[model samples]
Target: MTSRTLLRLAMAGAVVAGSLTALSVPAQAGNAPKTVPVRLLALNDFHGNLEPPTGSSGRMVDENGNTVNAGGAVYVAAHMKALRDANTIEVAQGDLIGASPLISAAFHDEPSVDFLGKIGVQVSAVGNHEFDEGYAELRRIMFGGCHPVDGCSPAGPWKGAKYDYVGANVLFKNPGEKTDVTQSLSANPQVKTLLSDWGVPALPPVSIKWMNGVPIGFIGLVTQTTPNIVTAEGIKDLKFVDEVKAANVASKILKLFGVRAQVVLVHEGDQVTPNQSPDACSAIPGAGNRIATQVDPEIDMVLSGHSHQAYLCRVKDPAGQDRLYSQGGSFGRVITQVDMQVDTKTRDIVRSSVVADNHVVTRDVDPDSDTVTFMDFWRDKISAVANKPVGRISADITNVGTATGESPLGDLIADGQLAATKTGGNAQIALMNPGGVRAPLTYLTSPASEGDGVVTYGEAFTVQPFNNLMQAVTLTGAQLKTLLEQQFPGGPNNQPFAKILQPSANLSYTYSRSAAWGSKISNIKIDGVPVTDTQSIRVAANNFLVGGGDAFAAFKEGTDVWSGPLDIDAFVAYLGQNNPIAPPATTRITAVD
Candidate 1:
């Protein structure tokens, strides 16, 4: 017999022997069938943190109840290398690039994608932030190319991500009506053609990897509410479908390909109970839990992100079988390790043999030398821009919200937006979404030693990183009141949570916490004058809010929209003008019990 034929017969005999043992028949010595052991190291919401994150973003509470500084690309690479074997696969749940630190964002997140590829991230789901620059930009990142506008600064001839980005739910909009492509992508005819491919997903829905002759399928899904949170212009030609439906369909497709072991990498996640250990599964109510319980039974595991919480869960599937569901914390603070056994004959995971744990990426270990070199290269490239002093702060203006949901940093951003648009757009007031304020402006000097109270351009960029364009729109007093009402849950717009907008100093309003949704808001005033329902008002805000993002639907009712400078540029100009800026009071939105 040929050698290959002999090997096949031996494998068949082993399977037969294993089957006989299951039926209570004794198996011959040394003829027992073996299962392939696979290891998965999963990360989520990395947000291009090539260096160790600062403040609370870089810290994690350990099992011992001690807070330890954690997370950096170098340490992540080291931990991954130490835990990986020949049968291992590294994956990310999503938010790997967008809303990144200045070093990564300045280069359009190319460095972060490059780092992910170098560390062998075989696959990742597309997070909503992946659409921050629009689908055309994401396509460029995936397929490799120079930036259309920036043209590959700091590094020439950029190569795209080495990993596959999958998003089953991200589908092209129907082309029956023409959709205008973003100006950044107008030069790329390929993207226009791709967007016209109706009924097709914007990205690959499933990624299949082979380990030890067993094919494992990964289905990726983003949150259905992505449109409400992301900039509307970037995703005008795309729609996000239900996660459960997409997962099941992808699972069926994998099955047709003779793949039985399946996993879902979704960008929707739930939070665990406060103060719980990293592996605790006391999950709070969220969409991710619903998805975990509803996905197809053939799917063996669900790895999730977007909410950026760390938790390990074993939710019961429809078949009453338990499956692993997990999320690693954001900013690389945690890494989830999943180990499972796959039956070679059935090509299915032994669900009972699955074990998962969340490991804190503490800085105690030695950094990976290769990743350090890579980080240094980018740091050098971005230093000149990053270290330049843009403003000064008398004290830390943090993004932490108060009892009324207003944040000091949010107030500062609103003031800046108003300043930028007041003259050009005839704007009277500005409102800032709390979510847009990413980080705090600290008065202390940074590692670069730029001097206390001196805020660098990098620090300011980190605070407002999305680069949304400022806009002024005319709204009647009645519509402005409706806008304020939409901040609460159960309001006309049905927002999931209370999103109190940070108002410029010229605006103030009071809300009753115990009142009915629409009735909660009252005492609205602008510039010390009570607003009348019939009065016309010109309000300033970023394009995101006026475009109805974050469920603020009332902002869409504005007329005579006037676009201004980028939000970041406005903020920088405000900082430069208001040297040694003090933290704004968080008293703009008053809450009554």
Candidate 2:
């Protein structure tokens, strides 16, 4: 049995002492019921960044407009421990792992799970990235076992996470038909074993926490749009339900259990402000805003993630009462501290007394000793593979694309994919999706003691960590035009937001936001020649797009398909071939809006 199973078993019968002082009411009444002061520490979208992030990705603008170096498991753990007390319970919104740096991803994200356990996380919501490797893989990570393919790490079999995973809105499907709606969730093999010992369902819809004879309910949810963002194959067997409905149902269940205080942890959020302060609540808006306004009034607070931006806002519930809606910035850069007063007799929150704040995880604090020891253990295991010099750059090649969707790093990646698939795929030009570009090739970042402009395999892995295979396909000029038009804001594709694809140097096009969806792209050219409808072009793209991953359905219509090496391999090879590479000009996608 894993430590997480033991933790759950222990929690089943444990009662934590409450530190709340009794409420002072009218003297006419014999002593009024006491109000327990409860502290909830929350963080979200920590995408396995064990070390301090690099370049702009690592720095956040403070309230004073000064750049503050932020993020690192070491500092995050330190902050979490310092703020924790008898009245505090640590929790997270989601995305604790997946799309991580090589140090963690190479080990199937075990290090991240271990670090979270060490920091004393009691419960966490399931983020979309949790499904990146498929549901079965996620189960393996949660239950503790050897990797079915790679087996265990040098440290031996995995012990699983000490924290419990919750997803009230995610359900299993029976092919095209839905399963029994009335049936509660069944835990997986590991969870079954653990629950068998606790005499409860393998997977409980809500986690009930007891503190000083008071019970608090926690419900976890993911965005309904998860199907569109995650790989199709990974989530084929799962069905994502409506967030508002799921929360309402779970709230009702908790109410039946005599638990009136509730918090909803969701994996969807919005980017309110680019340089927003940790505690700022101005102009907060996004999909999360919609969900926050629609959830049941019984929910006292909603913590969110996935947008990677930070903001603290209060949305009015259906009853016209204000409730908390907040998200901590991604990558452990920020933590949300929520203080609530609960009425002991009613076991309900004194809604008006709730308060929340977002704090930056500054690098100046002394790192946590345990977090450092844990990181060093994994860092030493992969030192040779991680420290190897792959290539060099004259300056920073960032993934922050332009309004037209063209970026220097994207262009370079497209160029690399083109070079990689030239012979095997007979490719003429290449197209890269902007989302695949994770981070920049910074000249100076943490562990940059080696000096600037040096690019290592680890850094390159961080830039293109998906490991998507390179594919070449044949598309008519008209089809290629359709592909470019898909980048617009509105279309039949029903894309709520714009996602532009980066084109190789050999390809160029002009677009206008004011133009209709189908007519937005114009003057499309390949190799400096005007593209004609009758011409057939060979284009290279990562498997994600060619297989219709980012709604680029036009690529799915292509014929004469061929596959090549992984994208990371192509990028590393390109760097070696073109030593001391410079940033490419971002003139490919010209926007006329």
- TM-scores of all models? 0.90, 0.90
Q: Write the per-residue lDDT of candidate 2 for residues 1-593, one digit (tens) a residue.
A: 23343124235332124111122222333565578888899888888899888777787766566779999999999988888888887888888988888998899889888888888887888898888788888878888889999999977899787777877777666433322222222222333333233222223356767665577788888888777666777778778878887788677666654568999999998877566676787535768988888889999989999888778888899999999999888888888899888987777889899999888888999999988888889899988888788888998898997877788999999999999999979999999988888899987644835567888889999998777789999999999998887766577666667887888899998998788889898999888999998799999998878877767778889999999999999999999899899999999888887
Q: Which portions of model 1 show Cα errors greater than 4 Å?
A: 1-32, 175-198
Q: Any idea how many clashes model 2 has?
A: 0
Worst 10 residues of 1 by lDDT: 1-10
lDDT of 2: 0.80
Question: In candidate 2, how many Å is residue 534 off?
Answer: 3.7
Name the TM-score of candidate 1.
0.90
Worst 10 residues of 2 by lDDT: 178-187
RMSD of each: 7.9, 5.7
Expressed as tens digits, the lDDT of each residue in 1-593 for candidate 1 is 01221012123232143121111123334664668889999999999888788777778887676789999999999998888899898999999998888999998999999999999998899999999999889888887779999887577777777777888788777635322212211223443343334245566777777777677788889999899889998899899999998888677656654668899999999977876778888678589999998999999999999888888899999999999989888999999999999987688999999999899999999999998899899999999999999989899888989988988999999999999998889999999998888778888898899999999999988888898999999999999999999998896676977888999999999999999987888899898899999999999999999999999999899999999999999999999999889998887878898
Most lDDT-accurate candidate: 1
